[model samples]
Target: MAHSTDNVILQGAHGTFAKQLVFRQRFGQSILCKRPKKSNLSPTDAQLSVRARFLAASVYAKSVRANPELLVLLVKGLQ
Candidate 1:
């Protein structure tokens, strides 16, 4: 699962053709995906990398916000 801005993308197995997933916050659980055309199959390597980074960053941001003291726990070794 990958997220950016207001949409989330999920790539099953690999970024193969027709495996692109699109989820919008406004959709309220309903997701959409576009099948790759004959000319294009799967996201480019760079695109995948960027998506992964975005997802990681988004998750990290949300996690930190949810638990403001997470850093303290990590640094203090579960005291």
Candidate 2:
């Protein structure tokens, strides 16, 4: 039998993060995105998370519609 976390792995592998695992890990604050030892150029996990959150907020702000009903419908569809 598959473990419960298998579903989460399946979703991560086949869903939007399929092609961007690094970005996904960064958003989740996973150590996978951490800068390598002795590396000075890459952004730290916290920095990447902040940037991802900012981008998400910007997109969500842009997606807000004047019609409250439309937003409700959109949320339902996403679920």
- Clashing residue pair totals per candidate (backbone < 3 A): 0, 0
Task: Quote model 2's TM-score.
Answer: 0.32
Off by over 4 Å in 2: 1-40, 65-79
Error of 1 at 21 (Å): 24
Could you tell me which residue pairs clash in candidate 1?
A: none
What TM-score would each prediction reach against the true structure? 0.36, 0.32
lDDT of 1 by residue, 10-73 (tens): 4222333446654333444433456444765689999999999999999987887688598667
| Location of the lowest summed lDDT over 10 successive residues in candidate 1 | 7-16
Which residue window of length 10 is worst by lDDT in model 2? Answer: 28-37
lDDT of 2 at 41: 81
Candidate 1 local accuracy as lDDT?
0.60
The candidate that wins on lDDT is: 1
> Given candidate 1, what's the lDDT at residue 63?
88
Q: Model 1 clash tally?
A: 0
